[model samples]
Target: MSGERAQPVREQGTEQDADVDADAASTEPEADTDAEPAPVTNGAQSVVRALENAGVEYLFGVQGGAIMPVYDALFDSEMTHVTMAHEQGAAHAADAYGIVTGKPGVCLATSGPGATNLVTGIADADMDSDPLLALAGQVPTDFVGSDAFQETDTTGVTRPVTKQNYFAGDADSVGDLVGEAFALAERGRQGPTLVDLPKDVTQGETDHEPGPARTPDTYRPAERADESAVREAAEAFAASERPVILAGGGVIKAEASEELRRFAIEHEIPVVTTMPGIGAFPEDHDLSMEWAGMHGTGYANLALTMTDCMLAVGTRFDDRLTGGVETFAPDAEIIHVDIDAAEISKNVQADYGLVGDAKAVLDQLYEAVAPTPDADEWRAQCREWKEQYPMTYEAPDDEPLKPQFVVEAVDEATPDDTIVTTGVGQHQMWACQYWEFTEPRTWVSSHGLGAMGYGLPSAIGAKVAAPDREVVCFDGDGSFLMTCQELTVAVREELDITVFVLNNEFIGMVRQWQDGFYEGRHMASEYGWMPQFDTLAEAFGAQGFRIDDYDEVADTVEEALAYDGPSVVDVHVDPAENVYPMVPSGGDNGLFALSEDQL
Candidate 1:
């Protein structure tokens, strides 16, 4: 089904400061107990109450000994705790929850292994800029350095991945720390933040306060572009004959897709999305060129190179987007509009840098610049490129099934409001290409870090956070094996979702790269000993279907989607297939290998 674009939940009291603090956050600890807590008291109780105050609706993670007190506190709380099969899954679920709901996702875990298990997901969140708040149970404060049972330096391990972290020293500090953790996770460039609550803190008793609503004093992103810069950008846009808009995740984060669409239409400019910015503009729009970069659409890469003015908004020109600084969009004088000042000239230097919130920047630019038509020739060229290098995949008559066709069929059958999520690799790229997302926050995947097991858990979070919407998770066979057990939670919770496994009996993307880049040395790539995926589904108490031909795709997908509960459709696909139109590492973006045989 079609879904509406998501809107961000803005925290009140955010003001622009001329001298912004560079640090995202600092240690927030308090010991005041002068105020009295209501009829109840305890550090754990304070923590739960604090979460409630921050408007947290769901918590995901596994429980353990050191965290029992917090669990006891949650016993009577309104927030729902989803016990994932593993802590890593919990972290991903929370990350996905935040992505869909525009709120900081919360995950709870015990110390030691539980805390460590969240590292991968934490890193994933860090790389993708997903908002998450992780709460961990620690050993007693006395045994912090002593390495007591189930003890771990949660703050230390997570510090590198988080915006900031806190150590709860007493009952009075638990509530304050929770508020700070939420603020930190949502402020600036969002990512994971943590609060390591020692067992003593949970057991300790004292009066607590949730503190005032946090307004970031030091870490405020620019809300609007400087007047001079906006004027220059408008002049640049007016002068350039061939211009393209490079939209990225920042557009999604800023909730500026509408503004982006309006700006693009007004200028009659073609738009290309960065990987994470897939849905920033409707793919079906005449001005839309799906995506550009390493494995992006061939026409998109060509347009980027050929454009005279490349207006990159809310995107860091990372290595993936810019194959090389000198060769990237060689003809374009790039004008970058971003919230972060450092990203201005970090990689591909911009002729003009306008630092501001995407929505505000686009709004002001819209007013400063009027619709101009100087690109009839450029539009003709882009349309020709799209026609000549159209996105296509072959389905050999003798092959079991083609993965791309499976995705296409599913896309056609799913509702207009369906939320499609994916694991990293061939499937992710296919989803990016095949699914026409007209709305933001509907497409979720692990883009930057390419975490394999991210799909299932994130799908769970999407389903949980937006129960009225339909969620479909596209997972690879290998990636599915990494964390398929989480499907059990779907069954237990009776969550309505469908998982499609592209069973190719190999690490499809890795094999594809090895074939092209490493002279066909396929080592440790194929899944020679395949598991019975259908049986695995049965083990999780979900219906499973296996298909060996393309004809079965339609019927099976329909059947699965129609099923009352969660189901897995395992369709055997061609093992030797590869994603096409890939630009080799360090290769010029203009010179892409259009398909597997092209390179």
Candidate 2:
């Protein structure tokens, strides 16, 4: 049921007496059990009841004194609440939930430290255009500038990162503010929104009626590509012997997979996706190529170099995507299409810029261009590139386990439609490399911010959003430990999600740098003390599996996937195994890691 349509029906007779008694007891002194019902319920209770009416099944947050009233109200309500180890975990979970479900995910936090902690997650959602609503409890309105305990200017702090923000001075506005927040967060160019509700306001009461349901203003996303522009693009595409489509996260946001596929197939153009765009095009499709730019496939980079025309859609050409802009695709005439005007020529200058929705733009392009005869020469060239530099991982015969083996096994065991979320580091890259993403929005990760410890919480949110679908987190041991405390949340909520931790006993990325740049002077990256993941999982009341042998990786993953509830699989991988094809920091993309002999 839609949130707007799920308003609760008030029950009639004797229940009102019980509610009245409970309300009376909630406000009266300890000795007075017969005090008249409190003058009115506080804004906190109003907000909680509003959420209940809106059919919110769960909320993620960490408790703080400033927000105690809201927590108290939540305890008395039916909505499930998941407490996180950190505010960032709550924010990331909310972002992931919104991305997976196309609804506004909510995160709650208190003043000062709690509000500041959510900054990274907010910026991440902003950069990636995910829908999220963050409710931050603020200090009382009277203490606005007093530097009072737990007080912070949350509205100011989140202004730049959020699409919209509200600071509630009137308690009666809480419900309407939340409704507006949800609408703004999910509107065009979707992004996070913040609502700062002061503690005093939360505890205050007013006689005003609850505000009417909010209806979001219709947003006509710019316009489709013009006839002339479509004709020009089609002419350029048809004439170029080597052309490619660079798809970005916008493709998934706009749900343009069908149009993208049709356009690519009709023109015999190969498609490459950005990190967030991994699942925008099916990885198994014949025309799909691995990602481009830093850490991209060798063949994809070479193809970018050789291509005569590049059509980029719904993407910002980030430094990672363009390598060094001065030398990237010098021979290619770039045609950029995006809904955001600021991104059109922000980095790499485009030969042509079309501002519009991805699906709408592609629809126009499809209409303008007539289906062409098969490009046998282009297909042959692409086939050669694919065969020569295909992404592959050969497990070492003597190694305990390879992360790629675990990733591949999980991919094979899970259905094609399953959603996969990842934490940053080797495991994230391995999931990108080994997992076959066939549907849009199926692969969720901290692509822009590259935040660690996002996997488990994000998986929790995804499962909540799509309860019928299988959700899994591909995490690293270091990242897992950072946010593993949230496991209790999964157990408490009984969320059906799987967490696969690649336990290598080291920060593999940092170790790789130490080996490459510091000549193997392994500093503080190694962990001499190890936590038993199986025990940790059991403590949280979830099934756990540990695999140390390469041969047992597949069976263990299968077992974890079959578990009815939340489960964790800790697969021990070779500590020395490093993610290769790396573009060294402060260097051009061409200066990638190579063998000592090559160097």
Candidate 3:
């Protein structure tokens, strides 16, 4: 699931003057209806009402003939629609919007190519458990299997990527289908869901007053943790001398970071996170050992290796975290708490599994158990490890600056509340290791799918949702090139975001692996030619800055942050530099192939 594949290049499209028609209804059902109110018109109009019922403020998409009817409805409605160059950009934006707002971010696309383009972003959301709703305009039911213009099976393509997908056949089904999609997207283990509406369904008249979006009759997310299980888990934690709290993205998804921190503090337990779990607890917390995975901090890995009891919350214990299930936390008795029952003991065997919402379970555990006060010695060892093997890197005294230095500089210049997003690969790993994330919903990335070109579009979405916050996207040269056209979208929307490109001129992470593991042979990892980043940004009407010298980093970052509108900062970094403290694929954290100088 984590294997690399060739990424799709973002396509550039302009409205080619082709057109369509729609039945636009009143935005509201009629404020004061003396006459039998205009029977609420078509399914597209009803769909908008349902979205409002579910509290959707923005719809991200690219306009096309198949989806033109929905766009027509938006003409008279209050809902804001953000236009992107491609459907992929729209879906990525929606994904980030959901991540930041804790709501099912909505996206729309036309049939065929548009829907297919959204597949990767939907897959990214599902892999990361980000809540999202993707709506696609399909061909009419009568034209099924007829090879109609711009026709494709949206449901079939999205089935594997989405949490659930539905094909709405008639106008009457639109409202409830939209509502149900939202509910399924947000409930029990959040993820992306879809409702494919045929063009006929959108244009067809419907008198059925589409009611408010409601939670389904049968589907209800479990909000309460088992009392006995909580008590037992807490007792085990209190009993163990070297208990470590392993928090995953589940903690953030459950909004349980506060409870997690409190539990760790009261019990004097060291805390480590999975890759997607960066912001669950403050990285600077006294008991925090930061992330524990393939590219995790050395001391954090050591903590995982040494722990006697691991109270893991909202984490799936994925391959990256476990390294190899047989050797992972070999000495630790794991107490896994997650909202999804299927995830419990799916990978790593859990001595105790509490299947419920992470926040709910942690709340009960905090109330039920008393911590042992004699964990001072164990706590001291965690602190000692932190001191001995801190995540330290010294910059090279030359041009083409160290990438870590750029991340650190950006972190220092930006406000602590800045929403930082990343495109996958070295920049992402560097940001995770270097940037001190203090708040939840602030660090966003495609951790599961490792999708390139996710940062700029997601940052655009985050900025759209939180207009006042400073959103910085840390992107690699390769990833940036993947969706660079989105900068034009950012400029047109007047989104206040700064995309900092670490120009390494290579597929840096893969090259690093090849160098270390494959006897220094990197065949297809390097890009022989690098794009002129500043020129591209300027062409997109965004302010651009290129910094190659280490001395100018602080000034460049400050200027870029101070810019009034969307901007791009390209910091040319040493192409040969690699992310360190790395555990090779399927290797234990303790068996890291560290840099010779590091060892």
Better of 2 and 3 by lDDT: 3
lDDT of 3 by residue, 490-526 (tens): 8877777999999888888888878777777979988
Tens digits of per-residue lDDT for model 1, 1-599: 00122112111223444124223333334535675435448888888878878888888988888888988888776578788899999999999998888788999889999999998888888877888999999999999999788887888888898878889988887888888888878866677888998999999987665664363477676798899989888888888899889999888888899999998998889999998887889888999898999988899999998889988998887778778768898888888988878889988889999989888999988898755848899999999999999988778788768888988888899776688889887778777777777778888898778899999999989988898788999988889989998998888777778998888888888989898888988899877877888778888998888888977888998999888777888878888777878888777888899766767
How badly does each model clash, as a count of residue pairs? 7, 0, 0
Pairs that collide in candidate 1 are 1-415, 1-416, 1-417, 1-418, 2-416, 2-417, 21-218
- Candidate 1 similarity to native, TM-score: 0.92
Query: Which scores higher on TM-score, 2 or 3?
Result: 3
lDDT of 2 by residue, 519-568 (tens): 88989989966788977899889989899997787778888888878899
Candidate 2: list runs displaced more than 4 Å. 1-42, 45-57, 69-80, 172-174, 207-223, 371-375, 586-599
**Alpha carbon deviation, residue 147, candidate 1 (Å):** 2.0
Please give the CA lDDT of all the candidate structures. Answer: 0.84, 0.80, 0.85
Best by TM-score: 3
Q: Which segments of candidate 1 are over 4 A away from where they belong? A: 1-40, 212-216, 371-373
Error of 1 at 439 (Å): 1.2
Roughly what TM-score does model 2 have, to 2 decimal places? 0.87
The global Cα lDDT (0 to 1) of model 3 is 0.85
- lDDT top scorer: 3
Clash pairs, candidate 3, are none
Predictions: Cα RMSD each: 10.0, 7.2, 7.0
Error of 3 at 513 (Å): 1.3
